[model samples]
Target: MRLYSEQRFGLVRACVARDGQPLLYAEGYALDPSLTLWGTRSVARLSAKSGRIGFLKLADGQEAMTDLSDPDAINEGAALEIEIAAEARADKLPRARLIGMADGPLRRLSGPLPLIERLKSQARRLIDPQAVFEAAEDPDALDIAEAQAIHPSFDLPGGGYLSIEPTRALIACDIDMGGAGEGMIHTPRQAAKRLNEVAVAEVARRVRLSNLAGLVVVDLIGNKHNGEKLTGLVRDAFLAESPAIACGPITRFGILEFSRPWGARPHGEDTPLKAARRLLWRAVAEARSDAGGRLKLRAPGPVADLVRQCLKDSLDPLTPRLSVETASVTEVVPVR
Candidate 1:
């Protein structure tokens, strides 16, 4: 058995080398004056086999052992050199500067086990040491399912609908109070307040869920004199819910402007507009091929008129099988 003990007197920088080649170096810091690694500490781990670098949390007194001989492929002969440096701290923990080296001939102690079992065993020991030993002798009494469902969703009262319309450049939500407001206090102001509160919460959630980026405008029901109050409420609600999100100030026009990080919109499974455009193009192509002539499409309504005007201005008439579609209130599935 090889015993490996490492204690930091002050700030320590540890370098890990494999096969006489420098693999990685890590620096540990004491955030508090007491020299305790309670808060976040920087840790860097680099791959010897691959040149990839990884950063992680370095908690004090955390030890891990692995065998190099097994299929796990841990190279135990890998040398580790630790360099200690002294720092002035008000707490006066200790001051020592020394270099340390360690080597181990790793050996496997047990076969591979399921992650759940390993975690359960580790947690049991940490939480209740006496119970862990007793429970080890009698394993049949433990209810695994109780531990599995640790965090479950609490059901919401309202059946809310969230509509993300990119064309409109706005997210409109229609929420039905849904039986929860049956016997409670009911007034336009009160109702608006409650709905606004719920909507604000939902907005933050949807922003995260949808990962929507760019200028977002929310068209919420206007509250009379409480407009400014409502805006403040929504702004405060979002700030509390998601501190990381950079939301801008709400304008007097009830437009809330903010930007999410750039990427593909989440849950962006084929929109109806895209589907309609695809179908329209396919149909126009088929029509042109059948007639062996150029196809002309007329503007149908206000939305279609806008699309036609746009097409005429933006596209060339000589372009083959040109297709166009417009936005509408009705939901239609385009057929090929």
Candidate 2:
């Protein structure tokens, strides 16, 4: 397994690729990582959402998560040692989350453990440190733009294209064979089937790439007779990528709904998830390359907060080489 990490524009973005396939995309929100568990011990704020118990950490909105469906609720702002849990494929609170409390004590979780730690634990295997990329110098390393474009809708490989829209209700995906483009067929059914085939793979990747969880409605073009036959194809496609997703029966209308948590919007304004990862990496590299005991990071509050929180693990090997310093610290060294 190889890891590619980058930091730029105050946000950090990281991707994990194995066997030449990108399996994971992790971003930072400083407060709202699509899935971020900050410090093992955090103050919890309780609430109710969709009849389920919701927990929020006032200090970091990114850590806002829900508790299991139980009558017991923790007092708001009560500090507790939180345990991390991961849901393999379902989207309603799918992905890694705080399942309960850890047995040990802590000084506020030492600030969210490095994402690499979580990534490593999930894989149950060590990452290739030699291949651990900080940027483009590594041959297999994909630039952040290419990494960000891993979404099928944005990275359509042929004449066929897809339009994905996320709403409060569900995510809607529409496939357009883009008619005159490459790999398109003359027969309408064949073209629709071919397009749907391509869409199956693309949709599967998109769902995982976007961290799209919750209810997802995919609209493919095909004859009603083909819907049943194609259902297995669609289901298989998603299963290859994530078992957490389950597709509902297809309607004559050619609509299929998938259940997963709603991920970050694909086409809207890009959130800071990627940028957070980038800054985190850049700071680490700069820290390791620096001569002083202090590594200076100069990002705004959110960006700096993410770097300070997520780079904990990577900082260890280089600790004696360099230490962490916020932009505000100006006596010894300064970085912008």
Candidate 3:
């Protein structure tokens, strides 16, 4: 496996590619990575309690939710060091597990480890993603991989396409033949089987790529009466990666269901602040590469304000050479 790091503009973006396929992508501030918060132990106060569900406030003022192993053992306002299991979502708090009570002051004891240390186990070769981005042609390899994680539709190997939509409840995958069998009306079953084969393989790769967890339902292209064959194909595809925690047979509606253990937050689920930071980084790169003495970056009003407010320090070095303005769309261009 190869890990690519693009360290620029006070941000570090990394992608892990195995066997020519990009599986995971993560980014964070230069010093502290948001990914490190998961799986790290920290001190937090039990702000509020409701039975086994407890609300925890970290020293940094962040809140998380975790089940109290012994609800009776701890009371509200007490301190406990908890291990974060997963990062937070837009509507949900981070998931944590109690690691026992703490005696010291409420603060981060250790954590936010170096990005390389956290991800080095999965990769052997360290690469530079920016090199790939600069050398690649239109639809760069890294860009295509990143787009697949965010975009809902991706084409199959030979033909057809699959739409993978992840909702709060489960991930739903829909497959379409889409002219894969245009002139083969005589062999509909044979054509459908081939399409389904391609769809299942792509579906499995996407599940790993997007870090999708929980229940996943796939609606295959053709409706045949072979449940075992469909599930077996999925199982074989996921055998290399972590096999599903549980795999269910295909349903009558041509749907297959399976569940995988939660790993990290799904890609493209960034908060507004994180998105703004990324945009600012892109703008900075544009300015650095331009030959003009001055450059103007037009971005959404809120995004412009974010950089001007919270990220002013990041731009101080390039002031006079770069300026930001509010526009409906975000882009950077050299000043005349």
Candidate 4:
């Protein structure tokens, strides 16, 4: 797999690709050596306990949870060492595992590892993003624009499309044959089976790409029998992408159910911090190109405050020209 990292919108964006196709994308503040949940060792105080689960609060006030072997072994407010296993995704809290009791001072052993280092561990070849962008017919614009897409659809290789609906409870996937079966000279049943197979493979890729977890229901374009026969294919397809998946048999209603583990943050979650970063990134780019006196970032109150708080960390030689102003909408423009 090839990996590329570039600074955009005040954050380091990384993309993992295989055979010239993007597999995964991630973004973060690379220079900040402060507290972060992903890939860090820190000390936390046990805030609460319930059976085998122990809730903890780090020195930076980030909440995490770990499995305790014995409920009564450690009391609340006790200090413990932890290694963060995964980041906070969707509504789920960050996950960590106990590394034994902490020593004298309750402190963080290390901050979050750099995002580029993390990507390098998994990638086979590291190439400059500009090279990839220049060579591709349509360079991948990895940005927050995806968060604006609520109900996204992807066209399948054949004549069909897959519509994905992500709700608070679960994700719903619908397979529309469209014109995929038009030229097929097989029986209706056979044609549906063929389309289902291709659709399931694509579903597996999308699930991983979006970091979709919890319960997922896929509505295949086939009958109950066709759904049942395609169960193994579904299982294998998901297994190739995510190994720890629990797949249920095809239901009588022609639906395939399965669950995958949550890892990274959901691909398209729009938040104030992301908006703030985007505005700053644009402001910085504008300051670099245009001979402007003041680059004012106008955003919503919350986003503007976020930009002000992070202004120091993101500023480079353009520090003197940077400013933040509250506005109903978010934008970065020059001010005389």
lDDT of 3: 0.70
- The digit string of per-residue lDDT tens for model 2 on 287-329 reads 6556454555555556456555555544345434433355643
Candidate 1: regions farther than 4 A off? 1-156, 159-162, 168-186, 225-253, 270-336
- Find the candidate with the highest lDDT and give its number: 3
Q: Report the lDDT of model 1 for residue 207.
A: 44
Model 2 residue runs over 4 Å out of place are 6-12, 18-21, 27-112, 121-141, 144-152, 180-186, 237-243, 262-336
| Residue 25, model 3, lDDT | 59
On residues 228-256, what C-alpha lDDT tens digit does candidate 1 reach at each position? 55456555534432443456655566555
The TM-score obtained by model 3 is 0.82
The positional error of residue 142 in candidate 1, measured at the CA in angstroms, is 26
Looking at candidate 3, the ten consecutive residues that score lowest on lDDT are 130-139
The all-Cα superposition gives candidate 2 an RMSD in Å to the true structure of: 8.4
The lDDT, on a scale of 0 to 1, for candidate 2 is 0.51
lDDT of each: 0.33, 0.51, 0.70, 0.69
Across residues 280-303, which tens digit of lDDT does each residue of candidate 3 receive?
Answer: 666666766774568777778777
TM-score winner, 1 or 3 = 3
Q: What is candidate 4's lDDT per residue for 101-145, written digit by digit as tens?
A: 986656789755676665543232222233233222222434422
TM-scores, all models, native as reference: 0.28, 0.58, 0.82, 0.79
